[model samples]
Target: MTNISGALVSLALVIGIGIWGYKLLVRDVSGIPVVRAASGEMRVRPEEPGGELARHQGLSVNAVAAEGVAAKPADRLILAPKPLDLTEDDHVTPAAMVATAQQDQAAPAPVDQTEIAEALETGNVEELVAQLTAGVAPIAETEAEVEKVVATVAETVAAEVSAAERQVAALLDAPGVRHSVRPRIRPAIPAEVTQAALTAETPQSVEVDPASLPAGTRLAQLGAFDSPEVARQQWDQLMTRFDAYLADKKRIVQEARSGGRTFYRLRAMGFEDIADARRFCSALVAENQDCIPVVTR
Candidate 1:
């Protein structure tokens, strides 16, 4: 009976120790300052701003990091740009700007629009040409007189040509004349020469002397003068200018009249034949000197 009581006492002590050990391990575990894990590390409940407990509760570290990235320069929020201050005291008006621009630019020279307007209004070709060339004004009476003289010269030339043709016909009919003889043919005059003869002389007032030219002379006519004296003077000038061509050659101032208007032709005489005279005239033309072949008979 003693032994049995001793065993029961021992069992009660063991039960008491087990109950105390369970209470110390579970109920008072929060009271412990630190708990060592298998790796000898102290287990801790993280209480940082972005802790595991906070992350699991929806405030994650990734979300906070994303917010930080947005705060950087790439995603920095910018304030609205300010509008232009148009009404400042230093601002310029459109009128003032235009006036300033005008002051900076140079004014153009004034033109004589009256001359152009007059040229357009009158429609007189000679007057317009005179104005353009700044030459002497043309006289209507002088032009009419010149035209009459030209007509007379043309008639005289026609008469001479007809006389020549008649002479040729007469020669062909003569018993003494050779049946096989070919008549001399005149060369065609160039348009340049015809145009020059029509309107090349410069207007000059001078006295005239009427005298006939030497017959059967093949000459080159350079120009016509108002007076025989002027023609002689022009010949002297031309001789001095073209001494090589005029050397050993004779010059004559021949008189011609038509419609009571006298004209003195300046002629270079002493060509061998009509062909020679025409060739010399061509040479003169090449030298910018106007000349026309003339047959005196």
Candidate 2:
């Protein structure tokens, strides 16, 4: 009997605790409550927390609201409007603006075309040349004009050249100017004979025996004359003319066989010095005009 009574008390305690917990979990709070409407219906008034219902007033809730939903005011701040009269005086009229643009678009004043054409056609070259020379402007521009200027210069030059040429020609053509004509004489030996002779240490003076003291040195044999008698006659004529001064002179006769003829030669003998001999020879040369200096070994 006592064990049955303990079991009945424990079951009553468990049932009372479960009922209190169910009431506490479903309770409303103290705030504005959220409302949920049906699919195509609108909410008239949202329920308040703590089971208090509020009137709808004029709020327009959209028909698509979910269960227990409500609308609230936005959190953004609003800006104030600016006054329009502050900038009212800065506007321009449309007509006045169009007239100002037209003035800017108009073409500039035209240049004088005739003056420009004249300036381009007659450039400043003549004016520049005139300024450089400090002279009057030139008017002519023809080939004849240029040729006339050239001819004037040429005439002046020709006059001076002709005067100089006449003076030179007169000097060249003067009379009685005894110009000497030296004959071309070839040595018996080769052309290098003179060079060899200069280096040969051979005596420059003629060789003679003292017995022929005033009887000149034998230079060279001149070869045979035309005839021995004719040669003797020529020598006697020379002796007759200068024998007084040539008394102590010597002569040289060279004989060679040419065409099988024998010839004799006679020349003036005895000159004390070569200068004396040359002077005598030169005098003879002036008179007879045929003698020359002879070289011999």
Candidate 3:
């Protein structure tokens, strides 16, 4: 048992010496150091309890110090900015308000209905010029604008005038309204009057010879007979009596056969000197109801 105790004591002394050597090697001597993360941030770790050397050296310490200084500057800049402050008195003043009210009251009212209608109908440039001279503010901004409006109005008026003139001219030139006049003169005498004068100058007498007329002229047969002997016998009896009536103005000029029958005709005295044969034939027709008078050529 005494030998086992001596061995355990020696083992304990060796483990204690080994632990002291490790603490002497790892303990920080100068200062606790900082380290940089992969994202370029600085961070601190606790120093080893019994170390001899520092872990973070010059480059790592300088980088952490720069990050801390940059963070401090950003915070100071954030704290330095301030919002602007304004009071109610910094807005509009009483004098400016009064001036604006006065300007609103001084402005002209809208144009009357009668004036607007007259302006459209007349399109008078002289009236517009008068308005400008009277200091109507809105319309008379510049000479160019006024002239442009006047030119537009004048063009409309000119077109209307031209259209009316064309309508009037067309009406005057219409076919029914326009007429052509021609003169007619009458002659001293007409052709019909000359014809009448010539007819009056001619002779009115007509000469007829009874012997040249047809044999049946004096005794016209009333109807047809079946036999020529019957017709001739009837004609002879009528002529024998007719001869006595005609003896005072005429004589028997000839006897002829016509239409398969015989007839005797009497020739009158001169009708050129006196119209006795026509008068006798007229008398014979008047006296004998069955007789008809026929004048020969």
Candidate 4:
């Protein structure tokens, strides 16, 4: 019976201890405030010292309650360490200095925008030309170089003339069929007739071929020459003057008789039409040259 009473006392003590623990743990301690850090961790308010270590942390007690969370009036503040000041001991390498110098050298100098704007407004082309040719050398043909070139050209011409003379001498010395060839015979016209031909000023009417008198039959008459030599000289002058127009064109110096007077007529032949002949004459007349387009009969 004594053993049963001891067992009952032990059971009652255990029940009383469990009830006290439930009251302490399960009961709401609404008065006690809890702090929350920025990290979302719950911490005891600085005023509530749960341990000796918490009280020694020298935390402030005055706090503001915000949304059921205690906020510290002044929490423990931390600051980053200040950077050390530079000294002569901080050395820069030679390569780094060289690279910096190169970068500075490679960078273009600052331009004065105001000066540029003023120059542009004033139309200062001389300044622009000076800038463009600042470092460029002028290209000039020196007098000595020109003289040397002329000398070279003269020597070449002399050599060619010498060669031509030697060739002509050789041909004259050579026995050939040309040496035995006779000169062409000229028509025997009376001196009076020739004089009249030379003085003739009027245009002559001449008969032409029917085939040559097609729809576009026109002749470009230059002049009536007294002699073939004079006609040839005039023809050469015309060839030089109208080289482009006369390319592949026929030049003729024909002897025509009118009223017992014979004269050599210089003409540019084979014109396709009167329009073409007129055009050639118009161009010549524009250049102060006299030319006539004769309609073929």
- Cα lDDT of candidate 1 equals 0.68
Candidate 4 collision pairs: none
Model 4 C-alpha lDDT per residue in residues 1-297, reported as the tens digit of each score = 899999999999999999998788766664476796586657656664664553424333322122222333555578999999878768663331232232122333445678778889999968865664554434463466456666776776788789999999988888865466676666555455444346322222123333444454577888998897898778777777776766655666667889999898877766878888988887776566778998755
Better of 3 and 4 by TM-score: 4
**What is the Cα-based TM-score of model 3?**
0.17
Error of 4 at 4 (Å): 99
Top of the candidates by TM-score = 1
Per candidate, the number of residue pairs that clash is 0, 10, 4, 0
Best by lDDT: 1
lDDT of 3 by residue, 65-88 (tens): 544321112323336568877789
Candidate 4, residue 133: Cα displacement in angstroms equals 61
Model 2 clash count equals: 10
lDDT on C-alpha atoms for all candidate structures = 0.68, 0.53, 0.51, 0.67
TM per candidate comes to 0.28, 0.23, 0.17, 0.27
Judging by TM-score, tell me the better candidate of 1 and 2. Answer: 1
Candidate 4: where are CA atoms >4 Å away? 1-216
How many residue pairs of model 4 clash at the backbone? 0
Q: Worst lDDT window (10 residues) for model 2?
A: 200-209
